[model samples]
Target: MLALRARRLFDGQEMRHDQVVIVKDGRIADVTADVATDVPAAVDLGDATLLPGLIDCHVHLAFDAGHDVVAMLEPPGLPDRMRQAARQHLAAGVTTVRDLGDRDYLALGLGLGLDGPEVLSAGPPITTPGGHCWFLGGEAAGEQGVRKAVRERAARGVHVIKMMVTGGEMTPGTHSHLLQYGLAELKAAADEAHAHGLPITGHVHCAQGIAHVLDAGFDSIEHCSFFTEDSYAVDHTVVAQLAAADVVVSLTVGVAPSPVPLPPRIQQRMAGMREALRAIQAAGVDFVIGTDAGIGPPKPHGVLPYGAEMLVENGYAPLDVLRAITSAAARVCRVGERKGRIAPGFDADLLAVAGDPLSDITALRRPLAVYRMGSRATGRVGQINQTAPTIG
Candidate 1:
């Protein structure tokens, strides 16, 4: 049992002041207003705000965030690197992450310790021959082949099914604007995934591909950026349709402050991407932070917090950005009941920042303490403990 008292607390949806969160085992027992207490065991986080540890809806543990991502995922010691990546996320206060792409079902095999973030694994994304991310060995084609692929993931105990509806910049000979699978094949994959009672997300970069994912009844859409051959375009009609549909958009946002230039295709169209995102938000479309971490040099595994921060920088309200990363993200990843909120019966994964994050979002970058499963996993306390959390 543990009693954690903080000056302020963001309960994943709202803010509260002077609260004490009681934890038993690995779940939050209760939360109440702080008062004079004889309970001497409380860990008082002075002048700090506690919130639920964040969740990232999409990430790729297989690909190390580097210039040569394809070359990085070679067979030797891949699992160890993935474990380190998962811990890096946990150390940075990300308690949950959905691995959307990986090679050879390796993400599921990594035994990230209890101190590590909970990983929702998608073994390998289903893609067409030579399609987006075809190098991960998830290439499939035709209705029958896609269905078989879905079944294979289900049998392997994957948490969700990922399909590449359009080509992506990562794969050679594949354009971000082109659709890889036809409607029939997409529907077949979605249907098969649903039959196994799994939610499926589509990796789509073009406007038409987003519509196709919605029409095929997929649970969510990834990278719905409406990219074209040369520049990007945001179709208002499609954005409105997505708003009306029972689907969520896993917006891949954020980049590390690096001198490296982004891929040519993305760099050219980067100016218009923010406008497209705002248009989607203006249409009342639901959103969750994906970050597409580990795909390149700018998207390291623990960079999800920067995604929320970037949204705020790009005109999104700070509160909304916080919600998108916490509660909304958990909902998209299908872990809403257990993760995100710091309420009773929820997982006791919490992050404590030195200052109120609601006021200064960058405070998240300076975590004072991170608790996983009701125990303090790591913390930085004054000049005595300035060490960053090491990979567990």
Candidate 2:
């Protein structure tokens, strides 16, 4: 067993000072304040805060985060690009990512290993023929068609089912305000997915679409932006309903510092989007951030830390934000049993930053060390000899 000592530890739920986490056979053996005498040695990380590695609930490894993401999909070496994207997330201390959309199920081939974060993919998101993301090839019409689509993805071993309930900004003919699938079709897809023991989430923008998904029994909603034809508005009633129903919202947030300007339409909606998010938080709706990384230049692969910072800036408590990205996200992704917590029997996927993130959320960007399943993936953690004294 390997003992990793850090000045502070956020064991998924809450913070504890001066803790030692023990790892054995790629899982956490124990986490205690007192170091055992028989333990071989402790890798003491000075002035660092240890946390369960962040999990991005929504991502698209197939997109290259370029000027023309759809065009980039047509090129060769797409799988290699996807792998590189996964590595960027891992290097940024995100140990798990759920690819909400990808082309040709490429995200599934990214094996769970130290090379990259553990990827839980939804293959190609189900959409209407010629609807949003139709280029990704997940197109079905009618209730029977939607059910067949869900069954196909489930048979392929996808962890979740993603359906386009509304149009998206990325697709030219599709409008974010318009619903893509009818209520009957949405219900069919949700029923088929749950019947196969998989959670189904919907890509929703307008308030109407959000309500439609909730009524259809979707487990979660993505990009709950509340977009209208000309602008966006947050419907408080729907927000209240979401909180009451206990539906998780995967808020699409995070924009990395970049010289390139945002797209004209998105640039105009920034202020409105912020206000909508504020309303969601105010209504006590459960939320986790999904950077929508790899969708544009501002959304590069490792933008989750920036997302945490954005939440803190917008009145979210650091402690709550931290849980949303770790334990809460794992539970939403249906991997809480193994991936999120820093307790005994959990995967030893830990991240140690240079300072306390609770006090300063930006500290997350300064990763001092990252461990993936008991193996050091990046950074140099300080190691002391067994004879030398170790920190708690």
Candidate 3:
């Protein structure tokens, strides 16, 4: 058994103080203010705030975060590169990630053991012929074809289904504002995935695509950017619809500070993107952050901390951002029972930072220590400003 006492704790929901978390057999045994004196080992983290390890709802481990990830995806060394990416997230205190797209189902076979985050994978996203991300090899047409595609992914044991309901910016011939799959095909994919006991999410951009996917009963929507042919637009009606629907929107956010500016197309739409985010927040839509990590130079595998900061900077409540990255993200990813909370019977996946994130959201960037399944994956207690001494 091991005990860790911290100055404060965010139990995946709210903040508390003077808490001690006890771990045994790779799970949290208890989280209480009463620290048992009989515990064989104890570690005191001074001037630190403990939080449940973060979860990134969307990432593409197959694409290395570079200027041209599609061109750089060489098959021979892809798996090794993916492993390194997963470790990057782990080291940054992200203990869970849902790989929404990958080449040849590689994310499911990473076999990273205790050193990496728990990976939930969608092997290859289902898309229409010549549609967005067709290069990843999931292509289908019509309702029947989409149903079959979902079945195949389910057979491969994918944790969720990712279907392209619209084109994407990454593909040259595609248009992010255009719908790729019709309502029939989208509904067929969602139904088939649900039949197999898997949740289905759609890659959508335009308001029409978002409405279609929501009508088809999709569990979630990704990149709800509401783009038009040339510039971007956020339809307030659709935003209201999203707020009233049962679906969750995985907002694409976060950009690490890098010398490379955002792509010209994205850079031009920055104001509209911010408007969409603000509208979503004002409408009180359910949301979680999906960094779209590994798709560009500004987005790296471990960039979730930046995402939390981005939301807070954009008029979002810091506490809400905290929940979005932790408990709310876990619920959307279907790991709510075990992965997100810092409570008893939960996996001992925890992050300790040097300061209170609620007060200074940037404190997330200063990770004092990370514990995955009770094993120290990165950081050290002594690294904090205050010296922490081990006790036994």
Candidate 4:
């Protein structure tokens, strides 16, 4: 058994000071304020706070963050690039990531071993014929086609089903504000995924697409931006319906400052995007952050901290942000039992930062150390500040 003492602990829900977490055989054995003398050894993490390893609900390890990811999809050394990206996420303290889109089921074959984050893959997202991301090779035209697509993914061992209910800006011929599949096709996809005991998530935008997603009974919605033909709008009525239905909204969050210029359309509509996000928060909808990592330069695989920090900066409670990334995110990913909390009977995956995050949210940016499977894994990339070594 290994005992780790920390100044404070955020056990995925509440904060407690002067705690010791015990690990045995790669699982949390116990957590207590009083350290037991029976523990053979202890590692004292001075002046640091321990937190559950973070989970980013949406990522695409196959898409290296760059100016033109679509063009680079099938480039040389693609497998090597994916392995590197997964490790980058691990080094940033994200121990689990749900890959919402990938080509040829490459993420499942990465073979990064224990050092990489736990990957829950979607293989390839279900899209309409020649619709958004159809280039990824998941184009289904009719209701039967959508059902077949979901069954194929289930057979491929995908953890969840991802469907594009609307077009996306990333694809040249597709419009983000327009529906890609009608209600019947969507319902077929959802019913098929449910029959196989899987959750279905829809990529939707605009009020009409959101309503269609609800009508089809999808378990979760992604990128609920409420976009229109030429502008953006926050549909409070649809938002209320979503909240009333108790559906989870996986908000695509996070961006890094880059010298490379953003696309003109996105750059112009950023203000409106922020406004919609604020309104969504006010509606009190269930939410979890999905960094949509690896899509471009602004969304590198390690960008989850920036997303959490962004939410806290925008009038969100730090505790809520913490829960969103930890326990809440794990729940949405269907790994709630083993992945999120720092409690006994849970996986021994934890992150230690140099200071209390409740006071300054940026503390998460400075990970002093990371533990995975009861082992001291390395995470030496994030920003850090030194402090006197002391223990209570």
Global lDDT for candidate 3? 0.89
lDDT tens per residue, model 3, 179-205: 998998888898999999999999999
Q: How do the residues 309-332 of candidate 4 rate in per-residue lDDT, one tens digit apiece? A: 888877778998899999999999
Q: Candidate 4 — worst ten consecutive residues by lDDT sum?
A: 383-392
How well is each residue in 1-392 modelled by candidate 2, as lDDT tens digits? Answer: 78999999999999999999989899999999888887886899989999998999999999878777888888798999898788888888998999999998989987647888999999999998899999998999999999999999998999999999999999989999999998999999999999999999999999999999989999999999888888878788998999998689998888888666888888888888999888888888999988899888888888899899998898889999999999999999999999879999999999999999999999988888888998888522322111211122
Model 3 C-alpha RMSD vs. true structure (Å) is: 5.8
Off-target runs (Cα >4 Å) in candidate 4 are 383-392
lDDT of each: 0.85, 0.89, 0.89, 0.86
Per-residue lDDT of model 1, residues 190-229, tens digit only? 9999999999999998989988888899999998988888
- List where candidate 1 sits over 4 angstroms from the true fold: 35-40, 379-392
Query: Regarding TM-score, does 1 or 3 come out ahead?
Result: 3
Best by lDDT: 3
Model 3: residues with Cα > 4 Å off, grouped in runs: 378-392
Cα lDDT, model 2, residue 240: 90
Query: Number of clashes in every candidate structure?
Result: 0, 0, 0, 0
Worst 10 residues of 2 by lDDT: 383-392
Q: What is the C-alpha RMSD of each candidate to the true structure, in Å?
A: 3.7, 7.0, 5.8, 5.7
Residue 175 lDDT (model 3):
95
